[model samples]
Target: MKLLARLRRAFGASRAAPDGPAPAQDLRLRRAAIPVMAQGTNAWPALHALPIEMLPVVDRPLIHYAVTEALSAGIEELVFIVDRGKRALDEQLDLEVDMLPRGVRAHFVRHNAAQGVGQALLAARHLLDDEACAVLLPGQVTEARPTVLAQLVAQFQRTPGSIFAVEPATPQMTMGSEGLLETAAGDLRLASIRRVATSLDHRPPADARLWSPVGRCILTRAVFDNLEQMADAQSPHTGDLRDVIEAVLRTEPAFSYRYSGRCFDCASPLRWLEANLVQALEHPQLAGEFQHLLRQTAQFVPVNEDLSQAQARALPTGAAAVTGRPRLRLVRS
Candidate 1:
């Protein structure tokens, strides 16, 4: 009963009532800030080989997925924070979206040099105009059926504080993650967050799963105010936005909405290949044509092999998926 009451207060307040989100214009007027600048490390050399957002995923550019998903969630304005040399992404955007959704607008904020995610976001502060905004990391691609982006936006409309989308992290998938969430006793709403560190042996109670922030958030002006203060103070982890979020949890009350779905970190080679294969296998238009091929590839190799080194390189370039090429199985475990 307490849980029911808590949920009612969160979602059934007079503003939200008993039905859907507040209104279309409430979401349409809001903006989404996507930070795209990343120092490409050799661990994943493909990022440096092409504009990270232009990297092919399921035969489509990565940014296409981000933009489409944002549009689906009713966010009409997008601010892309990019580094100086990364203007190539802007060109791709121009050529890709033939027509912007009714009132949607796309703008770019360029960083003079390579900096951390926090700085990239800070660069887009002018575009925010002191309103609440959504922050989406351009590197991760989520393929949830109902689209978790919509869920995050809905929560923001109802509660309107700093809300982040988090999913349970397996032991093996915890490397290089944003942060883990500590939820209230029996609820998934965030109570605290632990930032990623070089070394740590901490473990969560069995009732609580280690939840990683997947670069999707609804942050209010208060959070932005804190970000400005941190940017001015030159705080550590200011370069990484997750750390900035950790700093927010110190004084502000932030919440987490659990997403039990697939989210791939395309910046990672293994996950990137897996994301392509999974998304391709499920593509509505291409799935039937490629089903046999992908299934065959899944059986050809052991699940543990490093497909990134041997198989991913030998696969046909973007041309194959875009046009046509010799058939080959593409699979990931």
Candidate 2:
């Protein structure tokens, strides 16, 4: 038994336990993973002209939020897994590395042929050999009060295992994506993850508050072992991280840390536009810019309090309505 384990370690194969030196506590973050040649057209092709990983959010690349969040979580080292076609991403990271907060180190690994999340993680298996680490998706954006990354890390520290950051799903979101997760009634751990299409034409589930996985998580070697098992057995759920998590739940201790914050799905076209609008509204310096644009494009209605979609569109303001529906109403302070 011992001899077989020795051979697996010799070849750098995934062992049930950590093989190499454990990564330092402060270096526990794995940056976003995007395939080398992303299949199909992106939701926002023009915005994604520079790889989706490099798409801009506010004034910086989308990944910057994830990196900044990781740094804020006290993680000093980050591993970004990329593919051959993403050389632009590498160049961007190089230029930004110097500006990184002190004591932080970032490394990029090329997984050009990576087919799924498992393959991507396996590429950086060396870095994740540590006992615990967080994985952040570059394209996913959040507008949380305490910051989702900080909350996730704190949960992982308390729970001491895999922790997934989940937020309440919206009707539009449920209609447009796969792997909508259902959590247990009380404990809030995942109950089941249903594979469904996120098409608006389809009927959205009636659940008022379904917890959806938003791509930020703290992972341990146990999760990697499941990935390895899936790869070895050629399981159908090899690429999707949610499927892998479902498998993990059957064996290990996995917890869902529900956050009461707004999360944006940047992977979808319509949602991406909504996220941009929300971010623009929240930008301290860009408030005036957004107001100026709103005046030109739509009627600006100033309300005494925050109004819902139904209420905002009903009120009348002077200018011509915008190109799209809802007319971009601006609520007054």
Query: By lDDT, who's the top model here?
Result: 1
Candidate 1: lDDT of 269? 90
Per-residue lDDT for 164-209 in model 2, tens only? Answer: 7776666755654555555444545333333322334454456423
Off by over 4 Å in 1: 1-29, 176-178, 185-200, 204-209, 238-240, 295-333
TM-scores for the candidates: 0.74, 0.69
Off by over 4 Å in 2: 1-44, 47-50, 169-171, 186-210, 237-239, 292-333
Q: Largest TM-score belongs to which candidate?
A: 1
lDDT of 1 by residue, 1-333 (tens): 998889988887455565766555444326888776644656576766576678889778887788777877788788877766655776776764556666778887778535577667667878884787888876778888677788887767676667778866566655654455655446545444433332124665565455667877777766656766776777765334566576567567777788657788787899899889888888899888788765666675457755444354556676333233334446554
* lDDT (C-alpha, whole model) for all candidates: 0.69, 0.63
Clashes of 2: 4
